[model samples]
Target: MSTQPEHGADKRRSTSAMAPRNLARLCLTYALAGLAGYLATLIGMPLPWMLGPFFFLTAASVLGYISPIVPMGRELGQVAIGLAVGMRFTPAVLLATATLVPHMLVSTLYVIAYTFVAALLIKPLARIDSVSAFFATAAGGVADMASVSKEYGGDPGSVAIVHAMRVALVVAVVPFLVFFLGDHGTAPASTEVGATNYLSLIIALGLAYLVAVALKPTPLPNPWLVGPILTGMVLGVSEILVVQVPSFLIIVAQIMLGTWLGSQFKRSLLVRLPRVTISAMVAASFMIVCAGMGAFVLSYFGQMPYATSFLALAPAAVTEMVLTAKVMNLDAEIVTAFHVMRIAVVSSTVLLVFKLYMRMKGSEIGPGIQ
Candidate 1:
């Protein structure tokens, strides 16, 4: 009888000791996952390697949701992704408007309208909330929309699903669209650009890291609209000023963003996979239809060719869209602009509506947490 009490005491002591160790292990796992994800993207992974972070972090998050291993929320993720997007800006990107401002504006407005249309159409089919539908249907990348959904109190799971479907569908479909539509005489990327100067690459990576760290402290007023893209753009313009920003560094950041986005796919996240899959398909198809409409308007205003503009409207990552534009020798500037505009419009609209709703409800609004 005395031995039984002694054994129970030992068990309690061991459990207490194990808790902190397990937490340390979890943190290490997530850090490694982030690094691995970046490596995978560098080696030509179809998706971003940073996804490794999302995957493991998601697992930790789910565990925390049930018991508290790591907190699961989208705020930090949103800010990171947003800051990366802000880095995409430069004066040249704005210059796309010189001859095509009216057209670009029309195309942008069309895409915004189409997001609502997609929400309306897909709602009946997917059996998800209209806000969820709106997010999924937006003509922005799946990752961006998912982040916005979390910020606006929409269903993150559903947003993740729909956004994934849009990206997968577009990536699958757009290559063929390019093959069929691209001008037959178009040249592939120059061999000089591909030769890979190692010294340049190292310098670029260092700069990317520095810039990413610096931007972390900048008060990003609605980073989802301005962070990553603006940062990229500013740095890009610096290169034109003879500051010599390496191209490889920007690519590294892009890869990081992509990988991080993928990291959301943890085992625990799988629980809701079935519902997410269904919603994604319905939302993607509906959004595609809306993109078609946007393309028509862009064609009318910009007098830009229909194929490239349509591809711009296709729901995918800005990086992919811009890369495709460069490959097909289409106007990459327009593609980037449309992408940035879409995120800005969608995030702004969602936040505005959320604020109004909260105000009307007269409930407490929690400021976003880091």
Candidate 2:
């Protein structure tokens, strides 16, 4: 009848053996992230909540000041961003976005094609295998590409690093580039950030989280984000629940995303493969330039702003790009739509491309891939 020992064991298990230490680390990480976000805002930085924490933590992680990480931060951020963006899809906005489907499709293909070329560039520059290079160069989600690379016998670590470097470069550069171009004026936001209805927000987030849980067994790429977005779109378009996520919440989400992203920077990875990292940086930079060119073409044809077009076409760094669009007063809905479409197309076709290319090579999967 004595349950003291059993309860004590349960208490220990709940601690996770180092709960205090882990909690302290997490608190410190978040403190740094919060300070960085605030400082960014004070300094008039573009996408400050994201870029500030991202750059700050990135340097900290690299320089051994801290190894920043936030568990479940990415998913939480995605949900918040997804809901925020989903509210932008008014009937008029949706109608306008629909008109540019063809242009977006072309841009998506252009991105994929250029990424292939980037992969080719990586091969010689980094001396990495084809599978790793290809997956790394592709502009899909980093985790998604890395997983596929593993399946295709690619170096997942390399894929992750290259993708990380590419993401960091694009995020660090694109917003500033657009800012310097004078396109980042105080443009209209997607939705008005009205007085947040705390009750409504809690309900909405709860539903979105439930939706994510339900969709977890499915093949959705980013259910946490996608689920909330879809839900928000329905509610927004219907005008049934016109609630706003507090600015603080959105900033918190950005901090979460930035923290997780910054933590992905492995100093060891860079040290171990300096040439490969450099090659990835080069390829990423090249892709960014190509995206700029594509933006001009798309802007001309689509009759959209050059900045909007550019963000829509930018490779990798989807959330950051979309956030940039929002911050710059660009067409965030269009940007979000374009990124979603590209992810869908890439997720569906990338594996097929790799498989077919392997078949075309005949007999073997290529030493680069192997």
Candidate 3:
């Protein structure tokens, strides 16, 4: 009894001692991310704050220069970005986007079709389970798909890596295409940070937070982002006097998101499944090509800009695509709406389809494929 009591005390003391160190490490990580953002901004890189920290931290994490932590800030960053994007949805913008609904629906279907084809390709080539391939190619958030992968007896790590690669490829490739190939060569109109009202900002954020909390238990994908965007849209469309979010806050949001994304990559994870890695890269490339083709068709038929259509159809996360649209001065509202529909359709239907496939296939491959 005496020995057990002493050990408990020692454990408590160790836990207490580790808390401050962990906090300090987290602070240091944010500091480094901010510094990286600053350097990228100086060089005039596109979406400098975001891309900078993303590339820097990804390099650091892969090289063992930084230890990864749970990305607590990413949720807050998402809310911030969502709020900003929502503010762009004035009545005029909403009306303009209404006509694109049919196009959006068609593009979303294209996404689902391509994802299924990609999963089929991945299943045979990568030799992963059908469920894992389905989740990996579903084009939802990496974290979301990875969580669901466990339920279907899929490889969570493989799903995560494939989704990560898909996002990284889209983020890397789309920006260059927009800047070089698209007609827009200049940045969007800047938000006047000086016009910000602190009280309104606080109220908007508070409402966003409450909505996020309420939506937390729901099955909607990325509720944190969706809730805030909905709240902000109501405020914006109603002509309510919410202040513009300060530029620095937006930058901070970008930094947090980029840092979080970067930290997800671990060398060990990649090293374990070399074939999976290569297959994922190939699948990501194919998805991009599909998105490009779909975008081209939509743009030609809908008389929309190619860049806008591409961002709308690209199978990346909603937040990432929205951020890219903001940087490129495309129609962020349209992009957000399209991605929201895509995520909803994919998240709601993929599991059912997987289950049906299992039922039809019999016991040949119930769980993990190989």
Candidate 4:
């Protein structure tokens, strides 16, 4: 009986000691992420706050320089990003892009086909199971695809790594390609903020947070992102509020997202999965080429700018592409619409495709190529 009190005291002491250490680690992680973002900005990197921290954190994680705990503030960061995306959806912008729905549908189909082909190639080169390769090659959001991969008997970690690499490659490469290929002098329009704007921004954020929480239990792909986006779109379309997400908040979101993504990489993974990593990079490149070709086709037939078409066709994360479009002064509404359609279609059909593949293969469930 006397031992019980000592045990309780020891547990309490350990907990008290751990709490401050955890807090310090978290603060250190954010500071490093923020520094990386600042450095990227100084060098004129595209989406510096995001890409910078992503690269930095990935390297830091692999080098064993940072703790692996995901920052607690990451979800709030996502909410901020959702709000930013939502503000772009004015009724005029929606109406203007509505005519492109057919085109988006066709483009989405092409993206699916391209993803399958890439998966087939990676299966042979990487010796990954079919389900894993399929999910890894999918052109959906990384977290969404990773989560779905787990449900479909795919290796979620492998899928996540491949998806992260794909998005990183697209984010790093597409902007430079667009800039060199198209006019770069035009600047994106800026919004002026007043006191009323701040109030509206707060309301918009609150609505987004509430909606995201409500949608958490749904079967939606990326409910956090989708919920807030839908809420923001409604607000925008209804003209209930005209608000701008502050630049600082945007940077914070980017840092959080980047850090989260970076923490997904493990040092052991690099050593153990070199073939998977290299093959994923190759597959991603093939997909990018396919997207570029499709973009060229769209440009030729639709008489649209090649840069805009490239952005719409690129299989990068929708948020990343939309942000890039905004920065490059491209038609962000059109780009966002195309990506949303592509993701929706891909998310809905990916499971069906896996089932079909399983049926065709007679349930052996072996490594696809080896």
Candidate 5:
């Protein structure tokens, strides 16, 4: 009896225990990321907090420094970003933004079709399997796509790399292009930042975290990010929320997000499959071109600045795109709405879209994922 109790106790403790070496490695990884962010600031880089850490960490990881990763780093960053973006949604802005939903939906369909063509390229370009190509080219979150890939007999590793490469490329390139092509501060926030209400911000964060936890089991993508945005929108639109997310927190959030994204780069994976990596670069460029074309449509439809439309339709993570919009003084609300709609559509319909694409190819390659 005594032995059985000791074994059970040990098992419970073992599950939660962290080795000291692992903890040290984690600390070291963050230190490197922070140092990179600081250096980026010194050079006056665009979106320096994110881009700096992203490039440095990516290079370090690829150079075999370590298998870099940050636990819950992205989620924490998203919570802050979601809250900050949500506070931008005053009643008039939210209502006015709703009218553009139809155009956004059209763009979503265009993106789905774009990914379909991109996946086809993977076959001839990379000589990879169809199953892997299908998942690799999805515009949904990298983690979400990679996680479900294995269920469909897909190469999760390849999918992860492709998506990460695409995101990293978009986040890196789009801002510079947007800045160089035109002036700055053309599309500032529709609503001004109200007085800092730390109490309301804290309470809203706690509430958003709770709602995010509740939505986790649902099919809602990026619940932590979506939760705070929704909470902020409802509160702000209803005249309850009255504070901006602290600038310091937003900067830290950017650093965390940038570091996490940079950590996703696996040099070993890229080195092992150079052709796939090359294909990823081509696909990313194709997507960027497609986004630029879509930007014209959005700019015309919404009568907004081209830069705002470009970021709105940019093929990147919602948080990253919205943060870019905020940094450039573009219309963050429009960017947020477009990404929210795109992600919602992609997350819900991605599998169905894949099936349709397979049918179009006249190759019933994969059955429905369970």
Candidate 6:
């Protein structure tokens, strides 16, 4: 009996010692990862402002072989921004949607075709699975790609890595293109905050939140945010109110999104990532090709400028793309249209494809393991 008590005491002591050691090791690891991510950002990586942290979390989950469903904080920032824009849709915008729907569909086909080509190219070069390649080439935002990747059986680690690289490159590269390739002469003077109407903004937000909550049961991404904004915009155009999207709010949203996203890098993972850079480049080229085609098609339909179409087609965040349009003095309406359309198209297609794939495989692709 005495010997049994001694054994129990030793076991408890062992657990007590292991707990702090494990916690300390994990903290050190995360700190190193955060440091690496910050350094990568400093050296001119395009790290999508929100997608980066999500990627970091995803990678951590994958490495630990933990459940890959990590909560994304940056997504909240994106939802807020998306909701704000959704609120900007006036009655005129809604009316135009009738015409835009067909156009969006046509453009969607081209986007899908382009995405397929991206997947085909990535398969041979990336050594990643087909589903991962599909999401990687989806021509949507980095976070969107990650979400879709999870929907299918795609590797979360690869999706995170590919998305982080794409955002970094696009952010670093696109600004230069805007400065040089954009119509500097026609760029509008910056929006004046003093001229912004606060009552209208509040009304838009309130209406949007209400609509969003109503749409919560659906699988639409961030329905509470996107749905309400869309409804608010409709109301705005219907003489319910005149809403103004202020520049300061947009900037604050972007910075908050960007800094939080940028913090997901770990030096060790990055060092391992160099091996995957070629695959990422190939994937990026595939995305650019899709964007180029989208630019041409959207231009043909909306008669929107190429820069506006190109930004929309590029798989960057909607808020970031809109902000880019603002900075370049491009058309925000066109930017929003293409971005929203891309999300609708990709979400619907990916979900349908995943369903069919799971049915065929006799198992849930991205669902919890049996």
How far is each candidate from the true structure, as Cα RMSD in Å?
10.9, 6.9, 6.6, 7.3, 6.3, 10.5
Which candidate model has the greater lDDT, 1 or 6? 6
**Residue pairs in collision within model 2:** 129-368, 130-368
- Candidate number with greatest TM-score: 2
Number of the candidate with higher TM-score, 2 or 3: 2
1-370 per-residue lDDT for model 6 (tens digits): 0101122333443355356555565355445444544554565443332233334544554354221111232344444565555544555656665566776677667766666666667766878776776666666555556655765567656766776666666655565555565454253332333476787777666666566667767766546445755764566566566555665565445544454434344445556656555687667765776676668778777776777767867765566666566545666555677666767777767656545434554654555322
* Candidate 2 lDDT by residue in tens digits, 279-340: 88999999999999999999999998899889999997778887788667678888888888
Q: What lDDT would candidate 3 get against the real structure?
A: 0.76
TM-score of 2: 0.88
lDDT of 3 by residue, 295-339 (tens): 889889888789888888988767878888876767788889888
How do the residues 1-370 of candidate 1 rate in per-residue lDDT, one tens digit apiece? 0101122333443354358756665456545655765665575443333333434444554464221113211223333333333334456546654566555565666666665566666666777765566666666545455666666556766766666556655654564565575432243233224455466534443444455456555543333323434544555567531122233433444333433333333444445556666666666776676676677777666666776677667765555555555435566556666666655565556555444434554545435422
**Residue 127, candidate 5: alpha-carbon lDDT:** 81
Q: Give the distance in Å from residue 238's predicted Cα in candidate 4 to where it truly belongs.
A: 1.9
Model 4 clash tally? Answer: 0
Give the clash count for each candidate.
Answer: 36, 2, 0, 0, 0, 7
Maximum-lDDT candidate? 2
The global C-alpha lDDT for each of the candidates, from Candidate 1 onward, is 0.52, 0.78, 0.76, 0.73, 0.76, 0.57
What residue runs in model 1 are displaced by over 4 Å at the alpha carbon? 1-96, 139-154, 184-201, 216-276, 352-370
Candidate 4 TM-score over all chains jointly: 0.83
Look at candidate 6 and give me any clashing residue pairs: 33-266, 46-167, 46-168, 47-168, 86-229, 91-237, 208-228
lDDT of 4 at 65: 64
Candidate 6, backbone clash total: 7
